[model samples]
Target chain A: MTQKTDQDYILEVRSGNVNAYAILVTKYKDMMFTLALRMVGNREDAEEIAQDTFVKAYTSLSTFKGTSKFSTWLYRIVYNTSLDYIKKKKRVILSEHIDEIHEASIGTMQDAMSYLEAQEKKETIERALLQLPEEERVLLTLFYFEELSLKEITEIVHISYENVKIKLHRSRKKLYHILKNVVEPIYLSHGSRK
Target chain B: MEAENKKLDQFTKEVIQDAGLSSPSVDFLANVMAEVSKEESLVKAQNPLITKVGWMIIASLFAVFTFVLTRFSLGFSILGDWDLSSLMIEKYEMNVDIPITYAYCFFFLLVFVIIQINFIKKYFYRSLKN
Candidate 1:
């Protein structure tokens, strides 16, 4: 069975088969949910935002002009939807001002990570990710996990490619700053043994 | 410095990929589909049964009929050559013949107004929520 493309399902939807949208929703739901969850940092509100994004996407599907890939367009919608939600709720995410790193050794960070159990690594990364500013979390996730190009992210985030590159760099630096702090104790313990 | 940054970037990428993406509740797909279906229905329902063009056509026909009725006069002009003012006066005179009290009439008018208001409110409630 050849899996239908996103465009195929979209055309079916445009032609009046409303149920065809279920396939597209199922296809993208995980990525959508994860991205929304990362943006909002709460499972319940993340689910709601994901739901609203799908509904908004369906309602305004006609406006899609095929100028970019469907997933890119959908990302743009979810991105804006999350922003609107944050603005409406008057959410104030306390930001830790991250300085540019002068010396944070990757070898020590790797040693600390290998020292921890698998579950601890997962929880530690997620916890630290949640603490970073909202936009950076989104930028890093889209850049690394989704492997979206700078041009695609530029379209979704409405920033120039140069800014996207700069932000992505800073986001990586910020995330490294957070993850390094979590394993700083392990590094110190290894130093005492030496 | 750039080479060091690249190594750190590669390390973060590996660790993040290892931790993996977060999954929503098991019912997330069903929930979003439910909302989508609901939104589809709302859009469908908002399409007025009588389109604006339809209403315009009906209004044009009605105006034509009203004008024809007003100009309607035969060689035999019964009811005073079909004079509209006289007919209106006769209708007013017929109102005087009714046995209803003015207070009852006012009360009934108020009740009908309240009912109409309630009907409009009921019709718009769902749309307002959307």
Candidate 2:
């Protein structure tokens, strides 16, 4: 889908046309939620953070200087708010530990495990994504799902650009190891025996 | 480095496209915008003029109060032996020396004056012009 220029939306929203913000929210909600889901590892918390991010963006709308893309600012709020929620919850959600998830039965994972085996490996990768550390998870989510560049990710997370690169590398490596272990014979044996 | 980078890029692309992650619903955007509108309504309910005037009055009062206090403190000074000679001499036979407390008071008063004057000059010139 062709997205409208952020400048056009910002101008309209700032001029008291709040409905303009709806368009922006629609366009970026997926990107924002995906980032939150990865960091917090729960759909409920991700949805809450996503909603809170928009509310915050609205309240602080006037302070939004036009120097950076509005999406960058929006994503920063999502990342920070999700982090705050994670801290408040005091425990990582169970989804973060699962390395093998049967994709087809995502909706049915709670009822049956055998059904999940028929699903694609992609679901498992998402579950594996949750296993990553906060910094790495955020970097990967932003770079991949959000389609943000290294420089933009640096700005959103308030870290040095080099730090983003380093984290991205380490995180990707960890994700690969986790995914590989799940596919190995040891993992299969454990699953079959269970 | 190049090969690893290519592999990572490929993996990133694959994950984003193929992952079964649910996209945000259209209603989510509508809900957020509705919230923005609600906040806008709340801000609109408050009288901007009254808020600005109230802040201005507070700031002015603080400056005036600070100035008066500073001036009062500055005027108090330590009494000297000669200055108190008549009063002390008449009341008692003790010869005493009293040092003026003006230095500390005056220093503080000067600071208050500087602060007030600076605020007035800055505000009047910038705000009163247009």
Candidate 3:
């Protein structure tokens, strides 16, 4: 038998089988939570945002015209919910701080240390990701982690396609800068051994 | 410099691969299910079908009433020279006094509809809350 699709569950839910919605909630919870975590940087807040996103999606399921992929529609809800929380909390990403971050060039960083274990590099990357500004963090999460298409991301973030490309490029550079900051010290420490 | 840039790019790819999606707690689905159940109950309580049927029944009753009134008026006109007021009085005395019963039933139905409206309003208000 073919695997049941998101649309199958959606139709069932719309037909008054409310329990069918649980399948969708379970399927998308991890991605939604990760997106929220990247945007909010707080596990509790991320969980709350994720829960609210699912609840809102359930209530407004009828409005989901299915023009986009289910994941895209869901990510849009998660993105908007996290953005609302950030706005409500007045968590401003200072442009001046971004300018300072831009000054940290990845070109100057030492070469990658071969001795660094995979787990160590992973931890360092996660740390760098967490330290990034919310916008860059979220963009990276959506583009790299979730592997969403640029068009899908543009729809979710409600930005022009051109702007999404620009922001995505800038976010990549910002992530490189952050990764450089994180791994540079380790490179220096391992330089003597190399 | 070129080799170093290649190494950094490779390392970034590794990092990106390692930074996988985050999973919520085990109870996350259960919590969401609970909320869904609550919303479903609220929606079921305010089922639009029930509302539509209620309105349909009321409308049908009104239509029947209009038909009866038209028949009564036509009967009075057909009786031409007879005293209309005395005929009404005689009909009331001989048959069941429908006016008094109709007034009482209408008043009770009005109260029932008002109560139902208030109940539906309260259900909506509760549903809109967190």
Highest DockQ, which number? 1
Let me know the DockQ for model 3.
0.34
Which runs in model 1 stand beyond 4 Å of their true positions? Answer: A97-104, A187-194, B51-130
**Residue by residue across A50-129, what tens digits does model 3's lDDT show?**
99999999999999999999999998899899999999999866431243332224434424524457677666776777
TM-score of each: 0.74, 0.62, 0.75
Score candidate 3 by lDDT: 0.78
For model 1, the docking class works out as acceptable
Model 2 residue pairs with clashes = B78-B100, B78-B101
Off by over 4 Å in 3: A95-115, B1-13, B48-50, B64-124, B127-130
Q: In model 1 chain B, which range of ten residues has the least summed lDDT? A: B91-100
User: How would you encode candidate 2's per-residue C-alpha lDDT over A1-194 as one tens digit per residue?
Assistant: 88669788888888877778877887778888888888887777788789889899878978999788888899889989987887888865432333333333232322222323535456777877777777677788778766789999988898999999988877766665565555444445666899
Clashes (backbone N, CA, C under 3 Å), per candidate, total: 0, 2, 0
lDDT of 1 at B127: 66
Give the chain B TM-score for each candidate: 0.45, 0.31, 0.44
Off by over 4 Å in 2: A1-4, A92-119, A184-194, B1-5, B49-130
Task: Give the Cα error of residue A108 in candidate 2, in Å.
Answer: 29
2 or 3, greater by DockQ: 3
